[model samples]
Target: MGLLSGRRRPHAARRSIRALLAATLTAGLLAATGPAVWASERPAAARTEAAVAAPGDDWLRTEGNKIVDANGDEVWLTGANWFGFNATERVFHGLWSGNITDITKSMASRGINIVRVPISTQLLLEWKNGQAAVPSGVNAYANPEIAGKTSLEVFDHWLALCEQYGIKVMLDVHSAEADNSGHIHPVWWKGTITSEDFYTAWEWVTARYKSDDTLVAMDVKNEPHGTASTSPRAKWDGSTDQENFKHVCETAGKRMLAINPNLLVLCEGIEIYPKSGVSWTSTTPTDYHSTWWGGNLRGVRDHPVDLGTHNDQLVYSPHDYGPLVHQQPWFTGDWNRTTLERDVWDPNWLYLHKENKAPLLIGEWGGFLDGGPNEKWMTALRDLIVEHRIHQTFWCLNPNSGDTGGLLLGDWKSWDEEKYALLKPALWQHEGKFVSLDHQVPLGGVGSSTGISLSEVYDGPTDPEDTQAPTAPTALASTAKTSNSVSLSWTASTDNVRVAAYDVYRGTTKVNAALVTGTTYTDTGLSPSTAYSYTVRARDASGNVSAPSAALKVTTESSGTPSGAVKVRYKNNDASATDNAIRPSLQVVNTGSSAVKLDGVALRYYFTRDGSASVSAWCDYAAVDCAQVKLRVVPLTTAVSGADAYLEVTFAGGSLAAGGSTGDLQLRMSKADWSNFNEANDYSRTTSTAYTDAPAIPAYTGTALAWGTPPT
Candidate 1:
């Protein structure tokens, strides 16, 4: 239930801190010096180290803001963005927890990354003991005590799954108001809260997850300026709300790092274009009230803001939902060929991408694609996403929508084939029963490589009359645990020449050969503690084996955890606070002082409440009755640093008014690998040491509130 359930990585300085601790441990066990410590005796660092050292890890480094895989391949993000994490005030890991993870894994198989997660400010507000503060219209059931335990639990689950499945995430702070952006538009914190609250929110986010690579960056605030990107008032003059949008973002970026040094902050642009913008005009566009930025800076003339003042992690993200708002007649009546370019494509691209040096992250873009140029237009937009290697998180993952912005069809259990076909080519598929060397397809560009497309299909033999014994399958599963012997089987094949023998392929490495009389064979002398998957094919004198059999999976037991490490750095890719985009990465290295075999890699993260009960979960204070309203109480305890790999939040169910708390963070190492007595020594760290601002035993009092129904 803890909010800190996701996974991520860190910078060199923070990595050094981990290494120093490890080094200290090594020094304490002088047994290393006594034996001259052969490589096998050394303790293993995590995935980050092995990635950085193996020459293979170089693929993780950035090339002009884009991430490259270990194979030196540039990865184009093709995925959907989901909101309601912090935005809806859903206790992340409570009822709504794991919903996003389920959605992400489904989308990733279809090739979608670049998720834009919209956050709500209510997650940050807090009340003192016996103080009443609650947003109206919130049901006690919706404001469950589980949420108060660790506001971060949801974020934790979201990021961990993104990392596990190989997808990137963008943390977007959607609205300053309890209600989504509009009306009191451009507000930073909900309910006219202090600017300091805004800064505090950023500080909490950046400091805690700075090391996690999957958590790419932060969108400081969503749609700060009103729809108009043109007027001076559209840009903050540091007058209207104590501080303007620009000041809030830049100042927050500075303050955040003071708490967490590696922070990437992205400031978004207003919906309206500046007067200098191509789309700018005294009147709003016929289609909508607000105008798109279209490359024009609304306040450039007055304040002369330059986003480069922040760190390299800065990025500019924009939201363009043409069909969502714009009236069709403005662009075309006939709705045929040429008009699509004139209105939607040409103008927006020029202003947003061409004029702005900052990289673009299309924060939100989706619309009905039943007919007209909608499909074609989306194709053009996707092409731009690929061409620029721009990170994109579609507007949503809602299955309730009629295929407009919905990427997955039914609660992530099924795919909207029509929509998925448009994006499937851009993703990596992890589920299938075949050994495929070709998971990638050529995206076509400078120094391009062909993507391999391998599949296991049941295609009947070309000729059945020609009698010839078939070839056996190549890949087979092992029957024994400790033995290297594996049982290989094949589906019979028909060929002109007599079937000779079957060759077993272990990864790209071939391990054994056997004569194919029947359909199965067992091969021995293979090494132990190895994971091997195989596919078999029958060979004729012509050396052509019937297509390899369906791939089967098997792995040998290992003596211990593989030795390696993975390092990650998070950065924003744009300049606008509204466009804030985060990108995380991994660098693996081997530091055992000797060669070691690496099996596989895994990463995880934990999100904890900010040392206080969640503001979103406040119950009644002075005028309140906790039991009547079903509000739970969270008392202050010890300051938490690092817990286990898995952070748990167990809340006493029911509505908790203002000052309530629940939950704890914990690391998730193998229970058998360590002991219960040693759990505190190995995992527990004072949370304040890493982030001094985070309180220990996050405790707070509830604000006054009217009693409500008990939670179901």
Candidate 2:
């Protein structure tokens, strides 16, 4: 599912007799009842600043269902989610809009005492292996000081800024992939990642921040739920060891506690079975269900996870969503706070808190704030939090959530004042003590240091004389080759100070973002049956890059299946035009054995633009048939001042048979707008998958043609 589709909810049960009966009974209740009034008004705040402990003193631990300081005073977590480390981008989202320090300061001003950051295990492994890059464009432009730093180093920078701003952090292992889809694996381990690796990730993270008091806890795995009937290993069984939530939590939690006992172990519930009077058997009917990821805690009542020595530190965290995500049965038919609490809240996981079994943290909860059913749901949820004094974090502080938009909107610079106004009254620390209307007090104060500085933690060089580049690696050779990946090894390079890392490039495109420190590197995610050329460059601690090593080329094995493919060739059509412009032509061909149909094809062209230049428009000069193609052009920024643009031409419902071509489609650009076109620079092409026979495009080459004059 696309990220903009909103958070995916639990799969609805198939229509059956039981479902029909439940719907009929619900409708009957609505017909028999008159209009009812729910306590939708905001509940009065129960505790104030005097009731809570001072911010940022000692490490925190759970004391009888409550988080308390070393002095034993209560500490409430009122924060918002800033997701991204778990996303495909692998960095915080709004860094492009503002600095990390400034963003944290802004959150502090809003009475947010904590920040819940979601991350993925794969990203952690990449960072640990020194293969994570701090993506280019916006991220690089905004954080220029740490432009080439590894992802882990960038994460540390953000943590340092959080510590500087007096904000606590709860790390959430959101997914296995950097993308949004991995959260529903039923267990923390998925695909190439193993259960042992999952545990090891926690161990690494705990050890890294073991002494950092600002990082309070680890929110285990985000929303462990799938088919919960024991088939795919998602059942809540305490006795079983394989794929059991209790077993995994106890194992990982004990290890983490051993490393940092002060850290809280936040365990969430699974969405499975056990309705009302039903027994705890695998087949028991589960009437009530959790709406969001890692939300269904109904099983906690029967089998509360045993965290061993860290049991007291266990916090039962669950996520709740509004009608926008999914309208549970209780949400319909004379629904009010009473029905919602009885049908959905109590049976799911609220009973644990109501029975004083554990401290409850609403790990995530927020919606569009569109002032209707969503508004009412927010009000009721807020009432419960205020009345129960529960620890809470809003779904996000980002503007990227397609479901629950953010507390900040528009250019990401301005606050969603409406949300701030709604949430401020419920904050544990209001506008005076820990937070203020004017300025923020750094967590331990302005000069207080945690002994962990950027230089102390990061591997990048801190001195000036290390500017010399490392010697270029020698004898680069392909050790192994596969259809989708190539493994290469080369003689290590030496530098004046030390060779920090090596970069592997496929043609002119850098394939790996994280520096390769080892003599060997494996490049994955390649096209089958394609020839690829590689070069390696070494860099020193001071960011000096060496010249590329000798090139090594290899061809990957084929799939053996007859498939269609698209190949694009570029040529300088004209350069002597009177408008001081250059005309480029693209020849697309069906290079594969099968017929290929295309809805569209796009090319990302890179060049150096003149100072203070801008693209007025892209003009179509010629094509095989101009009437059969619709052309669109968009300008993009590849670097701080570089000109990057993509030209997309959509075909008018056509297909190119085997060895056929799109003839020549020509485009014109003003030389006054762009100069120094880097034809040698790697360009990108994307083929349309709209047709069943649209095979993946094989890799093509871009040539650097001489630029003197147009050919006669």
Candidate 3:
């Protein structure tokens, strides 16, 4: 893509080719752009683009990774991209000759029930500033209906056509500017167009269409891309920087949703992601795995987009293309679906669907080379999409797309019969009729008999109703207490349906502003020495709440001395939550006035056994000797959040002299089954590689707690 087709920017040199090809349409009109076979595979009747008096309440939300309607019925969005609004044309291409009415209806009748319209932020801003669009891009003699209308008006007209034909609309901010080759630029902002401008443009448009159910989604940005060595390159990260695509998408998506809560927010991935052991600092080519622009989603494994309360409205849209666009490395060898899924799709984007992280839409995928490797890749992806019910939008409707030719032939009136044949199986169909995302409206509306609405296909919800509640959380107990706060935890609850949330209660009043999704919770803002009681209840997706668990009462520690003289410093040998073994090196310093006997001291390293109860340990080395150290894993009698078990360390031989130190006692712990541990929430676990004070790892002198805070 010298990364071509990704930004679709001379280096989108590909756009020059597309621009030149599109320019020729001004002369030949008919001779240069004709379908291979001018056969009508379409339904007998054509639908008109008349405005609909009643638009369906067809807004959708996600369940697990499936897109479900208001009635909880699953619906697939089989769509195609109609470019030009994002380009210099400032409106849909092929409008010069093809009637927008005919094309929009043709899509609904032929199974393309949704359209992803690419538009630039600059054009939206121009419309926002009341700038009139020039009519040069529109051939008034050929299609006079929208002749004198502004670009915004033309888009509104298209939205009306979609509503009448039962085709949903999704707007994509393809670039910061209105230039034909704007995608070539990497980030969302450029020169005069700030990121705020990009966001405000969306707010204005969303406010305009808030009542219209026709436009259901907004692709936060087109293809945020650039290499590690390139400037203005987009990176997928947790940072709030301008170059961080994740933050930008979240910021923009949240802003749009604030205006229209029903809109599906599509966040696309960036072009490149750092490989294992590599950071953005590494400029070497091998340090990263590059994908088609907006296609690499590996960063999601670690830094997922946090929509907070609006997570159900989030969808991940990744764009993929065939080798004909750019022969990426995966295409180098003989590759099939299995290989591609393993090497490319799974790591890049497919995992989101598989892991139920989010809904995924292949925002761009289609090309002209239907004979060889390109078609092979396309065919494989099509199968995956059909089998998994993943949402998608094929690349172009205009043949002007340089790398991936249009789904329609150059003439723009006829569909590429061969390509449509391959894609037909992936479309949402019931019996012989294609399905519409709308509930009441039939696809192609009243004129065509080829399609059915979401209700017509399902008739009722396909999934069984979830009425059962999750089990109450078990073994709720206080983990730690401070002068001002108290931390609590419990065993995870089981649910017949997904456990949507955990509600924590102080006495009888709910203390959390939002439902807690995890087992651990820390309640702060309390009076020192005051008594408190806490309980937790689990809730399922259907709004059923389980009975509250047994309550635990405790009094906060009064303001006093800073605990004991025996202090502990620990270094995490491995910080991965899924690591096979936890290796934490412990060092104990004796700050007491007299010598402390090793046999009388005990250090508890709190962690989670993670389901495997049978545990073992190894004393890699000790200050005295490896044989002198004894390690025992003990599950907590009353489970507290983050820490379900503790590794008790006792010395068999060795005594700490006054003002003496135990150099380094390297220890390792693991379950007998060798299953992984989730150390992320462990109270004593630290991500720091260097040794630091571990107040969470409580120490004791005989029966008295000596150091740090222990679970009450």
TM-score to native of every candidate shown: 0.45, 0.53, 0.58
Worst 10 residues of 2 by lDDT: 32-41
lDDT winner? 3
Best by TM-score: 3
lDDT of 2 at 494: 58
Off by over 4 Å in 2: 1-57, 228-233, 275-292, 430-712
- Model 2: per-residue Cα lDDT at residue 322: 85
Residues 396-503 of candidate 1: C-alpha lDDT, one tens digit per residue? 666544336576555345666777666554343212211111111111111122211111110111132423334444335443332244555655554423665455
**Whole-model Cα lDDT of every candidate shown, in order:** 0.39, 0.60, 0.75
Error of 1 at 149 (Å): 7.1
Candidate 3 lDDT, 1-712, residue by residue in tens: 0122211122133234323432432222112111111101111111111111122467888876777666444578898999998888898899888888888889999988999999989888888788947646787876676777777777766776676677899999998888889998999899999988988999998887776677899999988898879887899877898899999878988898898898999999998888667788777655677878899888999899988788989999999988899876566433457546755787799878865668899999988765999999999999889766799998877888998888788787998888889888888776588888875556876545898665444332222354454588899987666565677999888653467667788898655432366788877566778899898877554344677899999888776623334788899887677887999999988876667788767788988888855778899988778888877776553356676667888777677887888889999988888888878888888888998888888886543456888753
Question: Residue 458 of candidate 3: its Cα lDDT?
Answer: 34
Per-residue lDDT of model 2, residues 212-232, tens digit only: 666888998888776435455
TM-score, candidate 2, is 0.53
lDDT at 433, model 3: 85
Give per-residue lDDT, candidate 1, residue 659: 29
Looking at model 3, how many pairs of residues clash? 6
